[model samples]
Target: MAAKKSEYTCIKDNTIQNISRKTAELEARADYKDKRIDEINHNMEIMNNKLDQVLNSFNDLKLQSTSDDKELELRLKAIETKLAAQEKTTEDNKARSDRIIAIVSVILAALTFYFNYMH
Candidate 1:
C-alpha cells in the first residue's frame, strides 16, 4: 500500500507539470496574436492617411481642370466675336468698291460719246 501511494503521487505531479507547460504555451500564443493585431492596426492607419492625401490631390486636379476649361471657352468666344466684326468690315468695303467702279465706267462712256458727236 505504501508503494502504490508513492506511484500515484508521481503520476499526479507529472500531470500538474504538463498542465503548467500548456498554460505557458497558451499565454505566449496570445501575446503573439496581440502583437500581430497591433501591427495590423498601425498599417491600416498609415494606409488611411495615404488614401486621404490621394483624394485631396484628385480634388485639386478636378478644380484646376474645370477652371482651365472655362478660360479656354471664354477665349474661344472672344475670338469668334472678333472674327465676326472683321468679316462684316470686309463685306462693307467690298460693296463700296463695286459702287465706285460702276460710277467711273458710266462717266467715261458719256465723255466718249459727247466728243465723237461734237467732232
Candidate 2:
C-alpha cells in the first residue's frame, strides 16, 4: 500500500509541472499578439494621414481648375466681342467704297457719250 501511494504522488507532481509550462507558453503567445495589434494600429494611422494629404491636394486642384476655366471664358468673350465689332466696321467700309465706285463709273459713261455725240 505505501508503494502505491508514492507512485500516485509522483504522477500528481508531473501533471502540475506540465500545467505550469503550458500556462507560460500561452502568456508568451498573448504578448506576441498584443505587439502585432499595436503595429497594425500604427500603420493604419500613417495611411490615414497620407490619404488626407492626397484628398487636400485634389481639392486644391479642383478649385484652381475652376478659376482657370472662368478666366478663359471671360477672355474668350472679350475676343468674340472685338471680332464682331471689327466685322461690322469692315462691312461699313465695303459699302461706302461700292457707292463711290458706282458714282465714278456713271460719270465716265456720261462724259464718253457727250464726246462721241459732239464729234
Candidate 3:
C-alpha cells in the first residue's frame, strides 16, 4: 500500500510540472505574436503616410499640366490668326497686280490707235 501511494504522488507531480511548462510556452508564443502584430501595424501606418504624399504631389502636377495646356492653346490660336492675316495680304496683292496689268494694256491700245490715225 505504501509503494502504491508514492507512485501516485510522483505521477501527479509530473503532470503538474508538464502543465506549468506548457502554459509558460503558450504565454511566450502569445507575446511574440503580439510584438509582430505591432511591428506590422507600424509599417502599415508609414506606408499610408507615403501614399498620401504621393497623391498630393500628383495633384500638383495635374494642375500644372492643365495650365500648360491652356497656354499652348492660346499660342496656337495666335499663330492661326497671324497666318490668316498673311493669307489675306497675299490675296490683296494679287488683285492689285491684276488691275495694274489691265490698265497698262488699255493705255497701250490707245497709243497704237492714235499713231495709226496720225500716220
Candidate 4:
C-alpha cells in the first residue's frame, strides 16, 4: 500500500509540472500575438494618412481644373465678341464704298454726254 501511495504522489507531481510548462508557453504566445497586433495597427495608421494626402491632392487638382476652365471660357467669349464687331465694321465699310463708286460713275457719264453734244 505504501508503494502504491508513493507512485500516486509521483504521478501528481509530474502532472503539475506539465501544466505549469503549458501555461508558460501560452503566456509567451499571447505576448507575441499582442506585439503583432500593435504592429498591424501602426501600419494601418500610416496607410490612412497616405490616403488622406492623396484625397487632398485630388481635391486641389479638381478646383484648379475648374478655375482654368472658367478662364478659358471667358477668353473665348471675348474673342468671339471682337470677331463679331470686326465683321460688322467690314460690312459697313464695303457698303459705303459701293455707294461712292456709283455716284462717281454717274457724274462721269453726265460730263461725257454734255461735252459730246456741245462739240
lDDT of 1 by residue, 43-114 (tens): 999999999999999999999999999999999999999999999999998998998888988888888887
Candidate 1, residue 4: lDDT: 54
How far in Å is the alpha carbon of 46 misplaced in model 3?
1.6
Candidate 3 residues lying further than 4 Å off, grouped into runs, are 1-11, 108-119
The lDDT per prediction is 0.93, 0.93, 0.93, 0.93
Q: How far is candidate 4 from the true structure (C-alpha RMSD, Å)?
A: 4.0
Query: In model 4, which range of ten residues has the least summed lDDT?
Result: 1-10
lDDT of 3 by residue, 21-112 (tens): 99999999999999999999999999999999999999999999999999999999999999999999999998999999999999988899
Q: What is the C-alpha lDDT profile of model 2 across 1-119, one tens digit per residue? A: 46555343465887889999999999999999999999999999999999999999999999999999999999999999999999999999999999999999999988898899965
**What lDDT score goes with residue 97 in model 1?**
91
Task: Give the residue spans of candidate 4 off by over 4 A.
Answer: 1-8, 104-119
TM-score of model 4 vs. true structure: 0.71
- Candidate 1 vs candidate 4: the TM-score winner is 1
**Pairs with steric clashes in candidate 1:** none
Query: Which parts of model 1 have CA positions greater than 4 angstroms off?
Result: 1-12, 111-119
